[model samples]
Structure formats: structure tokens, C-alpha cells
Target: MWPPRRSGGGDVKHCYARGHRDSGLVSGSSHVRSDMGDIGFKLKVLRRIGIIQPTSPARGLKAAKALRTWGPGFPSGVAATAARFPQQTAIHDDAGDITWGELKADIDRYTQALKDRGVGPGVSVAVLQRNHRYLVMTLVAVMQAGGRLLLLNTMASSSQLTELTKREGAELAVIDSEFLEVAKNIPRESIVLAWADDDAPDDLPTVASISADMPSDPHDKPEKSGQIIIFTSGTTGLPKGARREEPKDLKPLLAYFGAIPYRGNSTVVLAAPLFHSWGLINFGFGLSTAPTYVLRRKFSPEQVLKDIETYRARVLVVVPLMIQRLVDASSEAIEKRDVSSLEITASSGSALAGDLANHFMDLFTDSVYNFYGATETGWVTIASPEDLRAAPGTAGRPPWRTTVKILDENGKELPQGETGVIHVGNDMPFGGYTDGNSKSFADGLMHTGDLGYFDEDGRLFVAGRDDDMIISGGENVFPRELEDALIEHPAISDVVVTGVDDPDWGQALAAYVVVKDGQEIDADGVIAHAREHVARFAVPRKVTFLDELPRNPTGKVMKRELPDPA
Candidate 1:
């Protein structure tokens, strides 16, 4: 069980007051003490979340400083880290390792080049590239140049890219040469290629030429921090751009990083796509922690393990699918590699199936942590290894100063163990979508569009998306419960459950399955297996075998693309 919460007392106030003083944010004068009551409450919350240690004054001071300095955005953090750790290795990619000082130089050069192209505050610059050092540099440079960063998914089609860039009003697109054709819809002059080869097309200019003559001095900071417009997965339809501003308060940021145990001098191998929120958050954390970041343009499970062993990486940031791939790697291959250096494995982006979670922890020590959140609401809950071991499917408890509630269609709160739309209230909920539409917000909580319930232990368990719910013969069903049961079968490699049209039942469950190699399972066998674990109504009425399920770049199953049973 988790530790019990401490009672309210003057000791909490004293701890926060000392923390504030040590941080150099506040003086130890009577004037500061007059407001210690409110500051103390905030500190108490942070303490309860395990961000601030009760006995470690140095850790408290360091966390306080990190929170205080997080507001000026990416450029400021990069510059600060460079000044503090000039010789430290900041990023390692296919090209070579780059130090903090070298990283800042590259960012400054690109910032100057972008400024020369009239990119500044309010200007939207779309970046279309795979994971690499150039991509990282471009993101920082755009933020430094005071331009709104429009992150484009590399897996999107030409038409999808055209529509998104046009709708988002992007004036310039910095892309890899390979993706230049896909981004042809953008004006020729507006497109600048970054990762071009010797035989690159002659029509467009390259980022190399643009920055070759530019100075490495800092570019002017924007009056207001530029926004980062991250698009939704667009699994069902056109993706929406979720807008975020540089966070002003660092309390929530501190709480999250502190709870996750990301420390200074740590080495991290990031496997998730840079465009997604999970990868982006880890990038932000990297800047503050000044970790040695190992980057790869594409994900290969074996390569990820190799990088961990090569770099002695302590943490691996990934999505759930990446974890599955790692687990699926042959036992012989996994045994030959030395992954003993790994201390933590952070997973988000999608649901971490309970079976996958347990298998991963069993293979690699009990250091796996599953975080639950969406692009719109930020992070809401985190399931530690112990949480997964105790309650296999729980999403864990909310962090400090964050609240989670289950609400019905009428906006009334639901009791524990009753599934409803999950609503979250946090310090850093997204401002709104770029298109002016917003999710339902009542009181202070924002609707997450996820259907879930809290167990008796206050752990969150997501059933499925509210929109993904199916009414079959007047009995509502969620695909997650059935999918979870089906995945437990040894023959199942990967599986996704969806509701298809049915005559007798209003809608019927269909399972798209990818069977494991050397294993055989037919549609009838799948249904029979599910029947043993779940109710008859919950069993999939049809099962279609496939080489693999269609997935977006972030590894989410594309339900709309699943084929109908013959």
C-alpha cells in the first residue's frame, strides 16, 4: 500500500518556507512568512505527491529552481543548460554526439536563418521530419525565433498533410528531403529541406545553406511565448490541432518530474515519435535535466536495446506498442544483450495492456511506469510497477494538485466502480483547440472523452472511449474489456476489437487479430477462448486474421481502416 497522507500542521508550512528560501525565490523575512500559509499548502501538495522529499533540503531547492525557471520556454532552458553544462553531451544521434554548447550553437544558427526568412512571433512553421538531431534543433530554433511550432505526423498522407498545413495556416515548412514530395502542396519558397542527400532536388533551398552564413548569437525572444500546435491522432477523421502555451507555473511540472524520478546526469533513449505529446514531454524534461539523449530516426526494437547497452542509458521513454515489440523480440536475442543498465521504463501514448505490463516488468525489473493522459488534458494518473502488480489494469492515482472524476452524460459525478466519461482538473490543461472548439468544461474539470471508473483504491481504470462504446442488443459494450481478455491468449500476437453492424444485435463485436508465428488460431477458436473468459455477449462475433493491424505513427490501431468480415 502507498504511504498514508500527513495531517495538516505548521511543520508543512515550515518545510515550504525553508524550501522557498533555499530556492532564492523568497526571502526569510516576515513579509514572506505572512503568505507562507498559501505557499505552504501548495508545498504540502507537492510533498504528498513525492516530488519534494521531507528530509532532503537540496532536492527541494533544486526542484524549486527547476519549477521557477521552466516558464521562459525552450530556448531559455537550452541556453541555461548550455551555460551550466557546456561540456556535457546533450544529444547523440546517427550523425554523432553534440554537447550542450554545440546544441545551442546549432539552435542559434537556425534561429538566425529563420529570422532572415521573416519567421517571428505568430508565424506558423510546420516541421515534417523523422526523429533525428535536425528535428530536435529545428524545434528549438523555431521556439527561439518566436514562431508557433506546427508538428506534422510523418505517417500522414500527402492529402492529409496538405489539408492540415493549409488549415493551420502554416507559412513555412521545414521538411526532410524524403517528405518534400508529400509537402509539395505548400508553396515552394516556403518549403526548406533539412536532411537532404547529395542527389537532392535543385528546386528547393536546404537548411544547411540557410544557416551556413548565419551567426550563432541568440535570436530575439518573443514578447509572448510561441504556441505549440500538436494535432490529434485523427484515427476517426481529420485531426484537430491542440494548442499549448509555455507553462507559467512549475508546480505541476515539478510534481510530475519529481514523481517520475528523473534525475540529473541520467541517460535516456527516447523511442516514441517526437511529434507526439509523450515524446515532447520527455524532450522538455531532458532540457531541464540535461540528460544524454540518444535519438534514432526510426524505431527498431533491437536497435533500442543496442543503444541502451551502448550508451548505458538509465531510462527508456516509449509508447505501449514499443514495449510490446521489445517483449516480442526473441528470447535468445534478448538474453545475449546487456540491459542491466536500464533503471526505468516510462510508457504512455496509449493503454498498456495488463498482460503486456506484467510481462515487461517480469522480463526487465519492476521499473515500468504507465502514465495515463491525453494531449488535451495533460497527465492525470501514473501507474507504478507496484500499482500494476497489485491492480493489473489500474491507471494509478492522480498526482499532486490534480483531480480525476467520472461523470455521466448529464455531468453528474458517478460513484466508485461505475464507468462514465473521465473528467480531469489539472494545473496545465490545454488552453483550447486552435479551431476555437473546446471539450466540455464544467466547474474546473475538462471532459477527457474517455470512459473509465475509479476502483475502491482510487486507481483509474479506462473502459474505452465514450465514442467507441457499442450498444449491442440494448447492452452497452466497451472494446477494452474484451480486448484485454482476448490478448491473454497465448496464440494472440496483437488484437483490436471494434463494433460492426449487425441485424439481430444492434451492433456486434469484431476482433482483428494478428496470430503469433508458429501458432494457429481460427475465428472459431478465438470466440471460444473469449467465451471462457468473458460473457457470451462480450465474445467477438467475428474474427479476421491479418498480417498486422493498421497503426498510426504513434502505434494506435486505426479502427476505421479495419476490414469487414467476409
Candidate 2:
């Protein structure tokens, strides 16, 4: 069951019922006292589940004393975890399984190889590899050695990789053999480390003997160190690097690890690319919990089910397109597969509608969790099954430690029930954009460009992007509301709503649709169906059908490339 919304939006409460009270209050006086006791009990439960915290910072000093500590120069996360949980499985890749101990050894060797190649602190190393164990090894080694990591997409062309390499001013480029052709484009000035398929060289300097006796530096602050430069999906223009400033404190990481519901020993099917924040965070989050990760180089509906069944993956990050594909594959595929292992399923990176939320909840029962977040913002709010059941489109109120506000173009905070731009403030906000002196943190708030409004019921419903709104006949139309209605049709597989230029209306609503397999839907029929589902003005004035919608690697719809009909 979902918990009650907090005073400020975005505070999520996690509670699991243990047992019910047996004794019934006999007198009104007792009932009043019992109600007070119940409120106190719920407050304690909220604290335990990380929904609230003590105002007295040092109140938990005794408990904090018992927490595990990591030294500054910790070689790798695998090594650290190995010391804590040696027998536990650390990684499960196509190459094979590696325990925490074994993974640490690989990290040690990789660190030496990096050191041998003159890669030290302050240097940038670009990694372009599929989601394999090597990627983990590289990250561990680079971070352990106090270096910066720049993740590049394996699907990027040779020319694209070369440009990115130059942009980052990389000191080295590591690539899997499958993308060796692209690696060839990298400047010869940068060393190329290639792995032949999954069989990486054990002979590499990764296992070299370092001054281990050199009392491992307790505070290994390298010249320049931290996870910076997460690239955005170029839905508008060229991708920009979102630079992150490392927090001197680990409170946010600790808060996230504690707040996020992670079932231990569960298997997580990773379909998104690690180069993306969604995938990288999944990796970090999985590592924080030490869950089993079943990696996939790319997403295929068939493969998703197969991997879920094969590895008994209990959790996975999914986009809207993937959800539609998996649903279309077969409802039976979901039922027949041993998805009983699943406890939590999170969907993000796009707006999810009530109909789709209902469909998923009906299929998976209570496992579906709608997560609203962005690459810029880590995790803003999470809509639980109970929230979906109560208010389908409401992206659950923010987390316990987060704050959000909806504001109009005039910089005025909008009242409840009004749609406007969404701004957020969290403990772990990203630093800013790279390559320029621009800053997103203006007036102490992260402007989420996304337009949404809070309901009187205290739930936030995302409308669409502020820039994506279409003005038709002098009235504004949000694509998400219209898209939500259009997607309800059985014949529609996927769709994107955008504004196209118009002489009379200044701008008109246009829809680019991908019809379901073996089904035919024309522009007229699509618009007609929408007319019944939504306002007439919100219905598309034009429609273009394509075999598939143009999407970035992360599966986000590219509305800019929406083509006009001949």
C-alpha cells in the first residue's frame, strides 16, 4: 500500500505491514490515546524506512559508529565489497561469473595497466565498450587510480568517437574488438587498448605489483578526480556534457542507498547502455546493494524475456518503447515466464499514462513502480502501485528529502491545479554543464524544463516539456496528454506529438505514429480516434506514419526529426 504524501511534495514513505492490532478500543478515551500511539508508531516506521530523519544530526551517532568506512585511496568498489562480502558474486556477464574477490583482482591488474600507460590522476580515459565485465573493470581501475572516466557509446561511428575523444582531450581510449574499427579513428596520440570480444588479456598489467606495502593512502585525493561529464541525448541539438561536482560528503549516496527499495540477492536485467546515466546509476545502485546484474549489449523484446527467465532477474529499468514492445510480444510471454522473482519494476525517462500503468499493473500486479526523473536530476519522485491505483497519471510526490515546485514563465510559483515548468531541489543535484561557463542552478533551483502541475490531492502530473507545447488557434496543447490518449488505441504501437508550422494557427499539432504490426491506421483515423479520447484542438491536425519512430540509443523519441508528409 502507498504511504500518505508529505507536507512538501516528493517525500516518499515506505511501510510494510507486519501485523494488525488484536485488541479493539472499548472507550472513546482509550481510542483517542490509541490514535496518538498509532501516529507515533507510523512516525517511527517512516524514520526506519528512510522517509524522515532526526532533526538532531548527532542523535544517530552511536549507530553511525557501527557503519562501514572506506579509506580515501580505496582501490575499487569490488575490492571494498570483497573485503566485506568475499563469497558474494560481484558480476555476472556473458564472459562468465566473477565473485567479489575475483573482480578485485581484475581491477588491481587493470589499474597497473593504466598506470603503465602513463594514465594517472587528472588524466581522462574514454571507454567505448558493450555492457560487459570489462566496462566494470575499467571504471574500477580508473577510479581506483584516481582518474576521470569518459563513457562513449559503442554504437557511435568512428567519426563520432574521434570527435568525442578530441572533445574530452582523452589520454587513452579503451574499446572492445567489435568496435576496433571505430577506435582506429581515435588519434594515435592516445593509446588504444582493445579487448578481443569478451576474452580480455589476463597478461595485461592489471595484475602488476604496486607498492601495496605503501600503507594504502587513506585520503587519496588525486589531482583531478570525480565522476563528471554525463552526455545528454541530443533530442534538440548536439549532445552536451552535464558536468557533476563531487560532494565532499557521501550523505546523498548514503541516503539514496538507504531510501531506494533494493531487495538483496535479486537479479537486475540491465537493458540500457552504461554510457547513459540511467544505466550507470543502475550499475552504481546495484553495486551499492550488491545485487546480481544480467547485462545485455542491446535491448530486444525476445532477449528481455529470455534474460529475465534465464537469470530470474527481479528488477529492470525500462522505457516506454520497451514496455510497448514487451507487452506486444505477448501477455502470455509475461505470464508464462518465471517473472514471479520480480518484486520491483521501475519505468522512467518518459511520461507514462494511466492506461499503460493500468496495463502493466494488471500484468505484473503490484510490482510496477513509475519513476519520474531525468539525466540531470537523479530521482525526483516515484509513483507506487497504490498511487497508480488512486491517481494514474500522478508521478508520486517527491522523495522524503527532495523539494519540487511548479512555476510559470514569469518566475512565479503556480498554485495547485495549474500546469507550468517543474523545478526541483535535491540533496544530490548535478554540478552543471561542461564546455561552457553556463550554469543551470540559477536562484538556487534546478529548472527541469518539464511542464507539470500538482493536484489538490498533492500528486504531480507531468504535462510535457515547456518548449514542446503546441499553440493551435491561440490555445496551448501539451503533447503528453494528447499522446496518452492516442496510445490508448489498440492499433497504435508508438507515437510522437510535435508542433509543426502553420500559417493560420501559427502552429499546429502533428503526430508521427508507428502502427502496430499487421494493423493499418491512417492519419484521418488516428485523428478521429483522438477526437473521441481528448479535446478536438488537441487532436492532431496532421499525422505521418513511419515503420519506427526516430529515437536516440536511450529510446527517447526525437520530436525534432518528425517528418512532414509528401
- The Cα local distance difference test for each model comes to 0.76, 0.63
Clashing pairs in 1: none
Encode model 2's per-residue lDDT on 373-428: one tens digit a residue.
Answer: 88777766667767778877767766544667666676676654456667776666
Question: What is candidate 2's CA lDDT for residue 160?
Answer: 66
lDDT of 1 by residue, 411-433 (tens): 87654335677777766758799
TM-score of each: 0.88, 0.81
Model 2: residue 147 alpha-carbon error in angstroms: 1.9
Name the top TM-score candidate.
1
